[model samples]
Target: MQTVVTAERLWDGTSLHQHPLILIEDGKIDSIATHDSAPIPARAQVHDFPGATLGPAFFDVHIHGAAGHDFMEATPQALDTIGTFLASHGTSAYLATTVTASLDATLRALDGLANEMAKLPQPGRARPLGIHLEGPFLSHEKRGVQPAEHLLAPSIATFDRLLEAAHGHVRLMTLAPELPGAVELAAHATSRGVRVSVGHSNATAAETRAAIAAGAVSATHTFNAMRPLDHREPGILGTVLTTDTLFSELICDGIHTEPEIVRLWWRAKGSERAILVTDAMAAAGMPDGEYQLGGFPVQVKDGRATARGVLAGSVLTLDRALANFVRFTGATIDQGLRLLSTNPAAMTGLAHRAGTLAPGKSANLVAIDAAGNLVGSIVGGIQAS
Candidate 1:
């Protein structure tokens, strides 16, 4: 089937153009032309969005769950619930992120995530592109909400086991670079095609750089759980900020990072290296109350999610993240896609298929209001209300 969509504005991942025409066929974008130059067939199905801006769909590479369901539940229903919520928020795909837990429990979650990836994404749902392993090897000093008992030393054997359990669906992993054997483990994981990220660590600048040299390409939730930036020592946070090659994830919910700091981060990383992640747990989209994150209980009050006095996660949605990012950085909507769509897709090896609104790419896009609110979405060329 062929479909032609006309929008007031269109962002093709990098730049926004006025009055554009998009043609999708067989689940892929066939062509994108300006309104005046576009050839619209008489028999083609057409959908016009008058006041909405059409852009490449959002892609969250680091997310746990939403709508009262946690990905650790390891059930199709849990994924379905999360997927439905994400699609409605303009995300066409996401990584099913896991928290620190016992080996058995983590493996179980990995198995479930792999199984979910093997199946086709339901209509009007966000596709589960892969899994992000965010635990099992972290610094006790900066573990944040993750339980201390399950933290492990970096080991190739353990990583291999977890990788097997995920059935090669593990796209990214977060570990503390200061741990013993971390450099070797990072190299090993990178060799096998898994992107390694440094996070939840207390490593000094040198140690963090060593991990980056070992193929650690990113930092998770920069400046949140890791060592603080110091003038003399300049810990992991400093290394992350100054390193031009490393991508940094920022949770733009205002609670995890102050708006001023977010502005600074955006300035340093620019549009290319800065990535926005919610790090949101099951509390997202639900009212203020108690929620479960990775089998652990958490409290949500006044928009803050906490566990045992430590900040746990958030209740933020991608649409709001986009809005907050635009407001904080004074960036245009098209430039913001570098964080919300382009960087994540490129990091996870999905850039060839998804992430952009261009010919030969998946017809995954979003409809947003003038203020950057997601009003509708399209997944694999199928529109969602």
Candidate 2:
């Protein structure tokens, strides 16, 4: 079956087309043309959004879970629930992120997640493109809600074991650069095709720079679990802001970062280097209450998710993040869309999988109003329910 999607304008992760009509066939994009130039095929199903701009669906590189199901569960049901909820909020793909846990527990969860990734993707649901290992090598002082007991110094052997369990599906790993063997681990993980992100740390600026030289390409949830910037020492936060080559993730939920800080971050990272991630937990898209984040219990009240007086994760969806970012930074909607889609995809080396709408690509995209509000989402050529 052929489907035609039309919107006021289309941003194909690069340039904009006016009055665009996209042709999707067999879950792949067949062509993109202006409505006046290319007539809609007779009998083709048309999905028209009168006042919305169409862009690539968001790619969230750091998210715990949603709809009351933690990604650490690594169950089909859990993924289905989470993925469905994510798709409705304009995310077409994500990396299932894991928190710090015991070696045995982490390995088991990795195996299960690998198995799930091997299965076929369901229609109308966001795809779990890969795994993001966010734990095991972290600083206890800045670990946030990650379990302290399970935190380990960077070890190549342990990382290899986790990678094997994941069956090479680990796309990203977060490490504390100040750890003894972190630089070596970062190099090793990069060799094995895992993009390294520096975070959950209390590292000096020099240490952060060394990690970046060793292959750390991004920073995880900047400012939340990092050393404060000092005028003399600068520290990880300063390095993350100053380094133009490094990509940085920000949880733009206003709660984690103030509007002023968000504006500052935008000014530092700019449109090319900034990536927006939810870092969302099971409480996302659910009523405020208790929810699980890895092995810990988090309380959600008025959109805040906390554990033991420390911020655990977030209940933010990417769509809301887009709106918040625009509201906070006053960036154009195109810039906000790039932060969520293009930057994350480029950071994780998954640009071919998500973050663009082009011929021969999967028909994954979203329709949004000028204010960055999600009007609709389509994944694999199926409209999100």
Candidate 3:
């Protein structure tokens, strides 16, 4: 059976088409055209949104979990709950992010998550693309809520062990650039096809530059968990903002970053290098209360998630992040959409799997209003319920 989706306008990650009509067959996009360019097929099922802008569904490369379930659970039930919640909020795929924990526990979770990633994506659910290792190699001075005891020095041998446990499914890793051997680890991780992102550090400008030179492609959560920028010494935060080649992740929830700083980050990274991520935890989509981020207990109140007086992840969804970013930056909706979809996908090297609407691609997309609010989401040609 064929499905036809029509909207007032469409931004296919690269270009906008007015009166856009998309045809899907067997869950893949068959063709895209304007209403004036082609007639709708008589036998196809049609879904129309009169005043919505259709675009590629979001891809969250730095999410932990949602719907009161942590990705560290690494269970089928946990993934199903998280994925279903994510899809409803316009996310089509995400990286299963892991926080620092015991070496044995981390390996066990990785093994389980890799097995889950191997399964076919469920209809109307966001799928896990790969693993994002956000811990074990971090600066204790800037670890935030990441448990201190579990933090490890950068080590190729340890990374290799984790990668093997993940069955080579580790696509991204966050490391503190100031740690000894971190530059070498960055190079080695890049050699193994893993993208390195510098964060959780108090590194000086020169150390941050060394990491970038050694293949650190991005920065994690820009301002948070990073050395503050200074006029004389600068630091990792300064290098991240000034480096045009490096991608930077920002959690746009008003709690994680002030609006003024969000605006600053937007001006610095612009549309090309700026990426929006939820950095969401299990408390996302759930009522405020106590929640778990990895093995640590976090207190949630009024949209803030904290552990030991430090911000721990967030409860913001990508859709909300989109709206907040647009409100803060005054950027066009197309630019905001690209920050959540195109930039993150490109930064994580998963552009082929997501970030665009094209022929032979999965029929994953979302409908948003002029204000960048999510109106509806579709995954695998099925409308999210």
Candidate 4:
């Protein structure tokens, strides 16, 4: 069946087109016709958003949990619940991210996620593209919510074990590149098709450069769990901010990174290299209360999530992140969409089918009101609101 969705404005990942008519067929976009170019077919279904902006649906490559569900639970119910909640907020897909934990526990989580990812995504739910292993190989001094006892030193054998347990579903891994054997581990992970991101480390600038030389392409949640920048030595944070090729992930919830720092980082990385992520825990989309993140107790009060008096994760959604980013950076909606949609799609290796609202791409899109608020979403050509 063919369907036509029309909106007052359309952001095709580059610029906004006025009064665009998008044609979707068989879960992929067939074509895009402007108001002056063609007429809508009388027989086909038409969805008209009179005063809304339509664009590519958001993709979060680094999110943990939402709606009273944590991915570390490793259950189908948790996966489905989170996915459903994400779709309602205009998220088309996300990575099921993991945290630092015992080797056995982490393996169990990976096995469960691998099985879940193999199945088809239910209607009205976000697609779980892959897994992001955020810890177990990290700096002990910088471990935020990760238990110190479970932190492991960088080793090829352990990484191989994790790769096997995930059934090759691990798309990204975050490690402290300053640790022993980290450069070699980065090379090995890259050789096996896994992207290495530098984070949760106290690595020096020179050490960070060496990791980048070994195929580290991104920085995880910049400045939160890593070494601070210094003009004299310019630690990991300095290297990440200065490097042109390395992508930086920012948690724009206004709690993780300050609004001013967010603006600075945005200026540094721009739309092409900066990515937005919700390092959210189970408290996201739920009322403020107690929650669990990676088997540790956390307190959520007034939208802030913390553990042992330390900022643990977050309670942010990508839609809110987009709004905050626009407010902070004073960027156009078209440029902001690149951070949430284009960069993440490329980072996750889904650029062929996802990201842009173009012919032959998957019909995944989000609808925002004229005031820049999310109103609805379409996932895999199905309305999800």
CA displacement after TM-score superposition, residue 342 of candidate 3 (Å): 1.0
Cα shift from native, residue 275, model 2 (Å): 0.4
lDDT tens readout by residue for model 3, 1-385: 8989998999999998899999999888999999999899999999898888999999999999889999999999999999999999999999999999999999999999999999998878999988999999999999998999999999999999999999999999999999999999999999999999999999999999999999999999999999988999999999999999999999999998999999999999998999999999999999989989897899999989999888999999999999998888888888899998999899989999999999999999998888889988989988884
Model 3 vs. true fold: TM: 0.98
* Full-model lDDT for every candidate: 0.88, 0.94, 0.94, 0.89
List ranges where model 2 is wrong by over 4 Å.
none
* Better TM-score candidate (1, 3): 3
Question: Between candidates 2 and 4, which one is better according to lDDT?
Answer: 2
Q: Model 4: which residue pairs collide?
A: none
Candidate 3 deviant stretches above 4 angstroms = none
lDDT: worst 10-residue window of model 2 = 376-385
Model 1, residue 107: distance off in Å is 0.8
lDDT of 2 by residue, 1-385 (tens): 9999999999899988899999999988999999899999998999998888899999999999999999899999999989899989999899999999899999999999999999998878998889999999999989999988999999999999999999999999999999999999999999999999999999999999999999999999999999999999999999999999999999999999999999999999999999999999999999989999997899999999999999989999999999999999888878889999999999989888888999999999999888889998999899994
* C-alpha RMSD of candidate 2: 0.8
Ranking by TM-score: 2, 3, 4, 1
Model 4 reaches what TM-score against the true structure?
Answer: 0.97
**The 10-residue segment with the lowest total lDDT in model 1:** 367-376
Per-model TM against the reference: 0.96, 0.99, 0.98, 0.97
- Model 4 ranges with Cα > 4 A deviation: none
